[model samples]
Target: MGKPGFERAHHVAFFDAMATELPGDYDKQEVNHLTLSYFALGGLSLLRELDRVNKDEIARWVLSFQVHPEAHTDVDSGLFYGFCGSRSTQFPLSNVKDPCHNGSHLASTYSALAILKIVGYDLANVDSKALLQSMKKLQQPDGSFMPIHIGAETDLRFVYCAAAICSMLDDWTGMDKLKAKEYILNCQSYDGGFGMVPGSESHGGGTFCAVAALHLMGFIQVDLASNLNDSASIDMRMLLEWCLQRQVNDGGFQGRRNKASDTCYAFWVGGVLKIIGAYHLIDRCALREFLLTCQSPYGGFTKFPFDRIPDIYHSYYGLAALSLLEEEGLEPLSVELGILSSAL
Candidate 1:
């Protein structure tokens, strides 16, 4: 393919189709249907075409995934009352708090709240008391968050979700800001990039999670790019170097060093630069050309330029990356909260 265009119409139809029903290719993602739906709805938001979907109906469906405590005191039963990922994981509204069985997830809760916000639903209307109270329990002594209530991985991804949730709700009671900040600082590698956890290799996604979470939590006082001297917690200069280096020759970004350029990192790494106010330094023309090559003719975007089929995750990020470039006819993306500004 010789430079396939943005295919805005096809991309619109792609997200529009995904909003209603998922194809069989996403069978493994049934558990993450809400998150998947977020990609579609959020994708549409970035494209300035949210009116294509039914906001009220989608809001009702999203709310149904929220797990509720049967009693007010049950919030202390060590169970998370956030939204479950999907119907299959959702048990019949139980406060059981089984270490073996729990439905609600940090990522799912983030997606559900994000979807609600995207569709113009009032976050004040949500059951904040139970959700926030239990969300606190998900934070570990180290300040990283487990996606689920108990016995799950704790890393920067869930940390970003937690930060986004609290910021969206306009409340920080769900987590301790200083503690989360410490955990995030610990994840930053000597190279100035952040890993998913301490001692891991630096990655683009982890870097974004750490940086964006810190920004949402109000840890990055003022544009660090222009005022790096005041920063003591993170190596701002090294971080900026690490991020700018991610943009490969193809103009797309790779999640890590020595990896091939990917579509998602265009958003993952691109988002970090945007948040730090260094987005102006990248090769925008080269990046857009690379992203256009990844756009699927049928609809959506692929991870690589040569791939023909497109997935929802990469497709959403590709559009988001383009939004950062200020592409014509797209809504501005908030690189911090992982949702479009139009949604907020």
Candidate 2:
């Protein structure tokens, strides 16, 4: 068969369906509605068809998730003043007395901000001060951030989300960068890849979070030589080598050693290489061909070529990986931010 071509119209329809209404199979994603919105909105932005959505309506829906301090007076009341993951997670305006029902999450907040920016909404109306206050409370003594104020898994993922939130708001006051840097450094495994936490096994997603967080914190200087090695500096060369190794003979990247390559790692691992300024080291043609194999006949990309089912997460990252390759007709993606250059 000829090289798999992009099904532009079908992909557009896929995103449009997500924007308007999610299918029944997506009911499980109701808790992470903001994340779903991000994937959908980010996909549209990548397709250069963000104009297809009602920007004002989408922006308003996103803002509605924001928590207000004046709404509750309980101990946990001010804990979640950022943004909730979905409408179901949000406390109704009339029920401001119940703080237990309202909880803002770091990842959801990050997605909210990203979606807002992608839709061309000026964040002037965002309650930056309140959001920053919430972010500060989420950071533990160890410098890792919990996904929500109520306490949850603290890992590199939420750390990256906190960093991305602060970067978007142009406020470093939300997190202690020095402590965050220390935590990130500790998460770097002996193999040169980063893990979710100290002493954890190295993984692609964890490495991306750590690297992108450091870059957002201004700890990773772009001018730093990739070959430079010092006791105080991260070994960029070793990290780059580890990332490159994830791209197996199949051309697609695997999240971990001895694992099958997945579509998402194309961005997870590829984004890391791009951030390190060593993306040219990869086999671009083979990687592109591998990604094409994962593209579903219906429109979006699947997790693996044989999976046959497409999802928003893999689809967005697939497009992003293609963007990093400077694929024709695709917008350039900001590796660190994981959004289209135009969106940025």
Candidate 3:
């Protein structure tokens, strides 16, 4: 288990923001999408602040986004459409007032699904077969995945999303496993990490996605390890050594050598190490000081040291990184991680 890093004061303050049911100032315009909402709730749920909020109301709202199979335009298409935004924007206006049926996104689908699982909902309600069928359509021959429908941009992020979806549905037949695995393996740089695309600079976030996907798909051993002995080893000694060595005096983690660390990279690289079974290598005392300093006094968290513009995205990830370190009486998501790991 990871140890606590920062004080309880930070935890209580962050939890309070999550508990406050603020008016929907941003929901209609910006926060209406299920993906951002899911990221927000992920922070709250993983932090155990879900109890402080209305569980029934939130659960119902999340379930409402589920795309019933009947709504799909074609059975062969097997895609889910709809985005959850309130009545705010009149631009890109569709004939239908409701936004859910207008668009579909791979990122949104994965986040929406993850938020449901985080909230303890049963998977029985999900149309797994239809989702798998839709997933196959997005799979490119190169193994990268398009965002939702065909002709969308093919990239590493979508590849990770596709892998996560398959892992969640417990089916790989929907995707070309060999092609996807080959794509991930091909992206590995000379530095032994992955980039957003092949032959590009390595990034911690991209590395995490590639590694986590391979690990989830039962292919990490072959790619990350050298041989059978390395396959059985999950201690992450070597991997942690590489990741931890990337840390500077600050709490953040840098993707490349000698580069300054970013608050977000802390979670990406740190979270990856946690998955590799070596999160304990993080210096909790030092890292906590760095992360807490990044927190804005009004609420929310930021990147770098001593920055003030707090955002939901960085705030959520900052909390997650600290959770990995088990700081501030916060519990890590052992249950969810355990369930996902065992299934692989």
Whole-model Cα lDDT of every candidate shown, in order: 0.88, 0.84, 0.63
Ordered by lDDT, highest first, the candidates read 1, 2, 3
**lDDT tens digits, residues 1-344, model 2?**
67777677777777777777767888888889999889988988888888888999999989988877664454333476788998778777566775456678888999999999888888777989878876787888899988887678899998999999888888888999888888898899999899899999989999999988988887775543633443236777778889999999889999998899999999999988777667788999989999989988777889997567799899888888888888776778888887766666
Candidate 2 regions exceeding 4 Å error are: 71-78, 93-99, 223-232
Tens-digit lDDT string for candidate 3 (1-344): 34423444554555456445433554543534666566567666655666666666766776565444455357465344422232231123335565334345667667666766676666666767766776677777788987755255677887887777777767776678778878887777766666788888767877788767767777544322342246323333444566777677766678776888777877778766666555676776777777777776645677776787666667777777777666655556532232221122
TM-scores, one per candidate? 0.96, 0.94, 0.79
Q: Cα deviation in Å at residue 160, candidate 1?
A: 0.7
**Residue-level error in angstroms, candidate 2, position 264:** 0.3
Worst 10 residues of 2 by lDDT: 223-232
lDDT of 2: 0.84
RMSD of each: 1.7, 2.1, 5.3
- Give the clashing residue pairs of candidate 3, or none: 5-327, 32-84, 82-100, 83-100
Question: Model 1: C-alpha RMSD to truth?
Answer: 1.7
Model 2's TM-score against the true structure: 0.94
Compose the digit string of candidate 1's lDDT tens values, residues 1-344. Answer: 36566789999999988887889888898888889999999999988899898899999999988877765446777888899998889877454455446589999999999889889999899998889999999899999999887668899999999999999999999999888999999999989899999989999999999998988987674465554865546999999999999999998899998899999999999888888878888999999999999988779999999689999999999998999888998888778887778667
Best by lDDT: 1
Better of 1 and 3 by TM-score: 1
Clash number for each model:
0, 0, 4
Better of 1 and 3 by lDDT: 1
RMSD (Cα, Å) of candidate 3?
A: 5.3
